[model samples]
Target: MRTASWGRQAGGYAAVVTVAETAGLTWEKDDRPLRGVPGAVRRDHGDLVKELRDLVKRVGVQLGTLTRALEGGFTVDTVHPYGWWRAELAGHPLARAVVRRLIWEIEVTPGQWRPVLPEAEHLPDAPDDALVRLWHPIRSDPGTVRAWRDLLTERRIQQAFREIYLLTPAEEDTRVHSNRFGHLVHHRRMFALFRARGWASGLLGPWDGSDEDEAVRTLAAGAWQVRFFHARADWAGDHELATTGQVRFARRLEGTWREVPLAEVPPLVFSEAMRDVDLFVGVTSIAADPDWTDRGPERAYWELAGFAELTESAEARREALQRILPRLEIANRCSLDGRFVVVRGDLATYKIHIGSADILMEPDNAYLCIVPSRRKSDGQVFLPFEDDRLSLILSKAFLLASDTKITDESILTRIKRGA
Candidate 1:
């Protein structure tokens, strides 16, 4: 029933078909932009229709024109829902391209099976099986589930309770702003990761060289450097952690590295700490007293669970790192400062901050936060952070796209956005 064009051609499709799928009813919010959220679950069509109407009014444009604008240039906010949305601005080719990719993501794949609820009166107070089903499709893919892990590094630094990234945009700022307290406090987690390794055996006990083993060794031996930043401005005071900063380090101490206290470790040692690793798991705790508690041993022992070495010789970890890096790439538009990174493949297209964050473990799970330079649509204008909007937008966008259309637009939009 649909006519195909060059833009709509199936050959343009590229996103990997996920091996796993989620179950449940998917739904669209009855709001514009926000309504764009999608997932593998069933949702109400009326909600999407209401969303389309609201979006038309919000942007002061006709529905078709708005759709065209989005078709031309928009970003995918949801995947499973396959709902397409855009700001509805006139002929902006760049924006149009984004829309096309969004559209592509929606099309060229299996569509959701569940229908939307007709009214709020019928809505259940608790999240229902439909909601759970919606999450299942997303949950099925191990890679997709683990994609957000990189965000934890940022949280580790922000745990210090300061908007550190806003204070220093460049590494050079460290010297000018150097109050011994600010420097130490801002980088408390990095110091912890460096210090923790010396106590690795004591806390973790013996380098068995498991995955976590190599990870600990790489840090303890100073073979890796922590890079990334945590922007404090993005903190709403609601989230304890925010943003990740990364720096790669050169390896020197291969055989044995010793632990040193905060007082014993010199300031410039951070530069030396920069070595082989792609990311620095920012440290949250500092060895102010050089004392470890029963809790410390348990925490340290658990932290080493994902341990793995960083030698360039093995291809398996390299493959894992390859997978890990793409996920890390998600921070493209997200910021601890509430600035969004324009998600694009060309690293050169982005003006990024070279920094790192430490990873922290909660009783149940671990998380990260990072601080990086804000990328504008053009890499010139700096946008302020909007945590709620950004996170929800990306989450929805991921859910809307089928693996086949995650990167293509026209095809995705044609199927998702309708007459």
Candidate 2:
């Protein structure tokens, strides 16, 4: 079993709310800044606004820690005492709000866990000494998990983080990735992504730092480690380009860390760690750059990377699309083919790779490059969850579906021209 952590250290809601109310300020969900203040008020209350902003920022940062804790399996320290839970989690305003956003499990008997929705009933309604902990999809059966996903959808509940629909493919245990990421990614972007995902690595260079480095992240309270290998590509003699290699897992035996075959790692720990790596690769990979649709000499590399088999992240997107497509206004125009979302557009029939979000138009497999942007797509549909790539894919589909209506020259030029 993976080690357990309970997120009690999080500065609960903190004093930000109290200060906001004192200052006559308002806030939106996710601690977004106080919005919609009048012009005169904005000018006169500048100090108050700045102070509120700083406080909100602090709260967001603290909540970020709690989010990571939950991802790593945060349980209450009071394990088996229902009254203890009431005092620690249910009694407080902030804690109660946090508890409502997540699923909790009650262990009715030893070795048997039943996931309960916090909003469904009086959560952990068993005897005072009943065992309870935060529920994770990795700890539940697939059918049950799927049912929860459906419940979230039907109820239109937005999760603090992905709970259901999180991909934990048990079959992918033995076959880890090798020579995974390709192309030139600026070290700034790469390093920032690594830091954001809680991964660390040494410098990459010819001198001082080694030409190769292994970016590693410890998971499961130091029970496991994931190492992602990469070397300087030196394609243009620039150390900025990284040629990535194998992603391996290891176990911490006694006090020494030793590399272990992925099969030896527990499934939950493996899945949790892999999700971090997948997110890093998904966001930072050159395949994400829509402008790189036509790199003459590297066309093959680009195509292979873009059209490759779906990772767990892409699998989750596929699962979401299965539910979302029917609700889309362009429902008749879109359908999911293997590894691609096929959309029939006025300009051409297009295939968008679900994994890399690369697009290929039908006439001659022409490139239809649509970069990710904050611009809203031509629809007002409720999404059960949020994924940047999913939004980008849907936005691109909407654009292609209404190709003739697209007035933007950049997009029209790409649609009319071929690579």
Name the best candidate (by TM-score).
2
At residue 268, what lDDT does model 1 achieve? Answer: 30
- Put down candidate 1 lDDT per residue, 1-419, tens digits, no spaces: 01111111112221111110111121223312223324321132445444444543543333334333332221112232222122221123223322221112212223533321111112223321222111221222446423322221222111000011112244344332212111111133443554533312111212353111122333322433232222331221321222223332233445544433223333333322322122133123221111222344333532332122221212222222233223433544333211112222221112111111122222222222222123332422211222222233233223222224345564334323321
TM-score of model 2 vs. true structure: 0.81
Q: Which digits, one per residue and each the tens of the lDDT, describe model 2 over residues 376-411?
A: 743365565668888888877887788888888987
How does each model score on TM-score? 0.17, 0.81
Alpha carbon lDDT at 323, candidate 1 = 32
lDDT of candidates 1 onward, in order = 0.26, 0.66
Q: Residue 283 in model 1: shift from native, Å?
A: 18
